[model samples]
Target: MDFKEKFSTIKKHLLTGTSHMIPFIVAGGILFSLAVMLNPEGAATPETGWLGDLASIGSAGLTLFVPVLGGYIAYSIADKPGLAPGMIGAYLASQVGAGFLGGIVAGFIAGYVVKALKKIKLPISLKSLGSIFLYPLFGTLITGGIIVWVIGTPISAIMEGLTGWLNSLSDAGKVPLASILGAMTAFDMGGPINKVATLFAQTQVDTLPYLMGGSRSSYLYTTNWNGNCNIVSSKKI
Candidate 1:
C-alpha cells in the first residue's frame, strides 16, 4: 500500500478497535462512576459491600476493554488468528502499566506478526496446526516479550509523568487542559476523536474527577445551551 492507503488502513484498524471497545468503556465507566457516586464514605474508590463489588466488576470490565481493543484491532488487520496474541500482549501491557497506548501498540504488533507468519511456506499437513498453534505461539512470544521487557517501563514512566504533570497543574494550566478536552468533546459529539479524548479522561477518572466532571461533560452542557440559544435566535415567524 502507498502512504495514503496505509494510513487509511491503519485508521480503519483503529476505528474497528475503538468501535468494539466502546461498549466496554461505556458500561464500565458508568458503573464505576455510579459506584463512586453512591459510596457513603465519598471515597474516590469504594471498598465495601455491593458498591465495592460493583466497582470491582466495573473495574474488571475497564481492564478487559484494553485487551478487547487490542484483540479486535488485530482481528481487523489479520482476522481471527491475531486475536489471541493481541489480547495476551495487551494483557501483559496492562500488567506492566503500559495502559491503552501500549495495548494499541501490541495490537498492531500482533496483527502484523500474525500476518507475516501467514506468509511462511508451511507443508499442507502442518497448515492447520500452524493456524492455531504456531501463529499465536510465536506472535505472543514476540509481542509479549517486547512489551514486558522493552517498551513497558518507558510507557509506564511516560504515563506516570503525564499524570504527575496534570496533578501539578495550577488553575492557569488547567484552563488550557480543560479547553482542549472540551474542544475534543464538542468536536464531533461522540465520534472517534471525542472517544479518544474520553478514553484518556476516563482512564484518569478514579484519580482526576475534574477531567470528567468539569472538563468533558460540563463543556457539552454549555455547548448545548449555546446551540439552543442559536436555534431560538435563528427561528423566524
Candidate 2:
C-alpha cells in the first residue's frame, strides 16, 4: 500500500484496539493507585500484611497485562497477521520493565514490520519463509533492542522516582498529617470533610506508598461512617 494507506491502517488499528483496552488500563491504574493509597507502605512483596497483600494484588493487575495492550494494538493495525509476533514483542517489552509504552512501541514496530514483510515480491517458497521465520525473527529483534536499549532505563527510572516519592512522605510528617487525616475522615462522613481527608490520604499515599500503611485501617472506620449515616437516615425516615 502507499504511505497514506499504510498510515490510515495504522491509525485504525490503534484507535480500535485502544478503545477495547482503555477501560482495562484505567481500572488497573486507579486500582493500583488506590492500593498504593490504602497501603502506603508500598508492599514491595505480597507478605507485608493483609493491606500489603491487597495492594500487591491490585498492582499485579497493572504489571502482568502490560504486554496485552501492545499485542492488541498490533492486531488492530495489522489484523490477525500481526497478533502472534506483536504479542511476543509486547511480552518481551514487559520482561525488560518497559511497561505499556514499551508495549506500544513493540506493537507498532511488529505491526509495521509484518506489513512491510508482507509486501516483498517473493515466490511461493520464500513466502512461507517470510511468514514463519522472517517476520517474527526480525520483529522480535527490533522490538527487543529498542525496548532494552532505548526504553527500559527511562521507564524504570520513572517508576523508581514515583516509588521513592511515596516512600519519603513518612519522614517527619506522620503525626500531624495523621491527625489532619483522621479529623477530615470524621468531619464530613463522606462529604466535603471526607473528601478532604481522602485527598490528604491520597497525597500521602502518592508521596509515600511504602510508609503510610495505616490508610487501609481506615476502610473499616470509613464504613462506620456509612453505617452511622444509615442510622441517621432511618431516624429521619
Q: Which candidate wins on lDDT?
A: 1
lDDT of 1 by residue, 5-119 (tens): 8878987998888788878877887888899989988756788899999999888778888899899888888888899999998888888888888888889999999999989
- Give the alpha carbon lDDT tens digit for every residue of 26-106 in model 2: 455466665555665554333466756665665655554546667778777666667777777777776765555566677
The C-alpha stretches of model 1 lying farther than 4 A from their native spots are 170-176, 185-196, 213-237
lDDT scores for all predictions? 0.79, 0.58
Candidate 1: C-alpha lDDT: 0.79
Give the per-residue Cα lDDT of candidate 1 at 48: 84
